[model samples]
Target: MNENKIPEKYTYIILTFTLISIISCIILNAFLFYGFMASIIFSIYLCRKSGFSIIELFNMIKRGLYECKSLFILMALIGAMIPIWMSSGVVPTMLYYGLKYMKGTNFLFSAFILTSVVSIFMGTAFGTISSVGIALLALSKIFGIPNYILLGAIVSGAFIADKSSPISNLFNLTLETVKIAYKEAITSMLKTLLPTCFISASVYYFIGKKYSVVIENSNINNFMYAINSNFTVSPLILLLPLSIIIMLFLGIKMLKSVFLALIAGIVVSIVFQREGFNHIINAILNGYNINTNFVQLNTVLVSGGMISMISVLLIIAGAVSLSSIFQETGLIIPVIKRITSKIKSSEELILKTGLISGALTIISDQSVGIILPGKFLINKYKELKVKNCILARTMADTGTIIAPLIPWNVNSLFIFITTGISTISYAPYAVLCYVSPIITFIFAFLHKFQGRKQTKEIQVKNTIK
Candidate 1:
């Protein structure tokens, strides 16, 4: 037996071990850290049996952590940046203006579009849902719209940004793991994203026709008063987000751009919002707490802090450690190779990738879904000469968005908690959640057809020659 080769049965054992640990943790409502640790220890034991020493395993873990150091810092910065934006009145201003736009229109379609826009800005599906999503649900009663249908639209829209937004932690994490540039990933994602959005919007537009109801001016007035009374809603506050975009377009790195935005947010909070230094500092380290008489508005305004990011960071570290052993000890390569060897074309590989990602999301959460698939399939992607951006985009399209459709997934649970809409109720209406994967598969098959046509043309030219 080759000392270097890990037995195939070990791969199955490792996977079974990982699955049990994750599922057990989920059922126990325990932090995923415990599950991750158990898998790491089991993998280390398996790696030792395959001839790797303890020192080698330690080095692997260290290298994995070192590679993720920048990601950790970026995550922390994002954590701090969000709360600062909230306390600085930037979020409130955007919320105030975004809410004002919900005047006599197709409620379902408008909910989808508006939530998509806000989710992009906020970069948090939970935040988008708690704020605008809840607001829309309340209005659904007046419009005679089914709460489930409206929620489907809202959940669909909220997750759109979670999957694609530059500021989204998951989006950033996916890109980092796949080693793809942001601009390239976004460009590739748009091929599927635009079509899905268009189709979802059209469906909601016609469906919205049946539930048109005039908004009472008083409801709008109350919303305005609640926001305006607590925070100074100004267009000037929009400059913070714009500044980040301008910097990014100017070739500034995401880290520097976020840092600059955080600084700008601090100044705006002090100058415009009259936030105290202590409050700003507290928001940066802990989280922003908005004190308001309006409970609805209060729910939206509160959230964010560097501390909130620790759980995500821990998960990343654990996943990376697990991935590192697989990479270095040759534990998983055989199984992955066997799988990829059957793939005849890039399109097929893309389709398989979507299936794997969706399956992972069903079994685990979005972070694991993205990280493991990207790590496992990256070599196959490189071998096929397909750009990693496509892989990243595919994972985001399937894994990240599919979470909300899974009833037991954390994403769905959070949505249910925030909006009181169950996954079963809203999932059918979350058209984009399903449409994205279908669009990706279609693109894959379309490319395959195009490739065959080109090959036939080449053969004909050779015959003429």
Candidate 2:
């Protein structure tokens, strides 16, 4: 008999209790505290039933805590760096130039592409959505674009970059958890992401047909003037962040790269902003505020700080703790086993796993969706003789891309709260999010574009020689 096994009724009880806890946490806005407590209790219960001593449970907690230390430290550093960079005029400079380039174009597609690029650079969907996304929303009102379409385009663009960004925490988390090379994971993602982005861009282009306007060369000049007048702009400032991007592409660890880039930004700020050391200290502590004559530029530039990310950090910690408990309690194992057992074919397995992972985003959050499922599904794919690349690709497509589709999910909620755009309004325009999983499933089932055969052929030739 399995010591951890509970009666079927008790399993239902646990599930029910967990659901109630989660819902209450959400309703009461106490998700962080309640989630942490619930996780601890569940972990204790599981360990006790499994015949583990309190010391063993404490050790497990300690080990789990240690495992997340690096991630926490990285988060804190990023939290600090965001405001410093903002105050230094780096983000505002990008937005200023970005808006200048967008003048008198198909604004929808332009917004989509611009946000996509920036989000990719930022490696954060929420950051992209909050910064440039808010600007685009304001632009939508000015240009008379339908609100739903604008919302869709914004979400589509942000997710396109978010899904494919090498610097994204989810991207790195998935690669590390699956033990796949980061380059291979990115390559696999590109295979799925590029096509989905093409479709989404096409959709936005056609939708914006009526709104297309020819940009006069002078209009571009005026846009540039507007940006320059509004914020203290510098091109060299981008070099610091660009170096990090180059380093990431060259396979440096993300945390180290970010840390170095952040230091470079601080140095630039000290020199360029010409603010006193105490002023820099105050900005880092309380957040940065940029007051510009241009309200739009002011809005775009006003973002990021150590204080801003505390809420997100708390939410992440709570969600991760609950996820750890769910894992240790064997709840997820039964679910994974049941799903994997039903998968009779490789195609079915891939599709099933993708859908399950997508569904899990509603409850488990994106990190858990990829990390937990990626770990379990990778071995299953290997045993099935399915290519690990395909599994990794599917995980990226479904797990990372689908988060914004679930209204209550963290990413979606963040956008909804920040942009005041409902998930329902944005659902149709977010073609990449909806289409990626479908495209991935189609390829998996139809066996299209599979390079694994070539890999296998080479392996066989080597063996025969």
Candidate 3:
């Protein structure tokens, strides 16, 4: 006879133990690295108790890493690409033109849209925050807009492309985890993204009416001048981001696209900006560095390198190991099945997925937040006839977007460090973060009605026959 399976209650204990371990690190302000390690240890204990041998557990981890091997390589390429783009003047050039064309009338509205554009190009929240976000906050002081409200809009826009951008690590991770195609993921997410952006833009416009300040171009001009002085500003640099996007849409692999872009950046840095070959090599290894008289501009221009990706890689490895253990031991299946048994409709499923994602994001940072929920809930989504694109979109809608809203989360902490404002202070006004989930759920409800309508049409045709 087969051996008896573990009780359902054991699943609960495992999940609770894992969450507590991770949450403790956040509470104590310890590195999340320690938290992941603790979770890994506890998960190993659970796996062993369930009769998994050490070698079997190792194989599980190896299998998970194999699945994620592409993501690791892409992340490292992004790491190298960022510094090259910075040193090659691609980032600075974009910043120059973005600030030059930024609307000064509806300052709040302008801040949201402009930051969204920059974030789309930069493909990371922290980088966008440190660069355009810093400059926008400085302008907010001049326009007399509240720092909190402006920061809220900035943060909102900074994350718009987290799920949609081709170069975004978060986007790729969600895509890779769900095994969805790039085209499908983008198409699915846009359904929610377009509406949220419109609503957010309108809200900011109306709010701008509450505060009146004349548009002063001098402050903006100074920023442009500072950027222009540091590096060459040209339309040719636009080719770097454009090339990656073009190749991605044409079905080129993400790794090849990013790698090609890195090569292009190197050439641009050498031929256009005239950066020394040694300086370029150093940037790829360590990170780009620069010194300038403009203190504000100096901070934004420097960052990125392969070395900067080590911590992220380590965290991903640990999380993947933990996820593998859960999969191998079969502990999480019973838990997911039990919870999903109560889910009656597609809308309910989407709602619960969002809630789970939000909870995970609260307990862990963005990476683990997306990783765990995607792993656990994907099967239920398939059972419900839901497309994996929706699963990817939901995780991005809830976990990835809501991350910076939490005060102690890593993304929030980085925002605090960069902007010197508390997360709670600005979170209320981060319209996109709040709007995305609402819009997504609204779409879910609409999807349900559409499904019902289709079923009725099929029934009518059958009766006529």
Top candidate, metric lDDT: 1
- Model 2 poorest ten-residue lDDT run: 1-10
TM-score, each model? Answer: 0.72, 0.75, 0.72
Which candidate, 1 or 2, has the higher TM-score? 2
Q: What's the distance in Å from true for residue 348, model 2?
A: 2.6
lDDT of 1 at 128: 66
Backbone clash pairs for candidate 3 read none
Of 2 and 3, the candidate ranking higher by lDDT: 3
Kindly list the per-residue Cα lDDT of model 3 for residues 232-328, writing each as its tens digit. Answer: 8898887887776567566676678788889988999999899999999999888876888977677656665777677657766776677666655
- Off-target runs (Cα >4 Å) in candidate 1 are 1-4, 106-193, 203-218, 344-350, 356-433, 447-465
Candidate 3's C-alpha runs over 4 A off are: 1-6, 103-194, 206-218, 344-350, 356-430, 442-465
**How many pairs of residues in model 1 come into backbone collision?**
0
- Per-residue lDDT for 168 in model 2? 76
Model 2: residues with Cα > 4 Å off, grouped in runs: 1-12, 27-36, 39-55, 114-191, 207-227, 292-297, 365-385, 404-429, 447-465
lDDT of candidates 1 onward, in order: 0.78, 0.68, 0.77
lDDT of 2 by residue, 1-465 (tens): 132454444444555666677667656756344655674586568546756576755655566556667656666666666666676666656655555666567888888888788778767676566546755664564455776788788888887655667677777777777787878777777777778889889988888877655333224454457567654687786676567657766767667877887777777777876656777777776676666564544544444456655665665565555555555545555566667876656878788778767756766677667766777777778887787777778878887788888654667656654555667778877877888888898788566345457668899999999
Q: How high is the lDDT of residue 31 in model 3?
A: 66
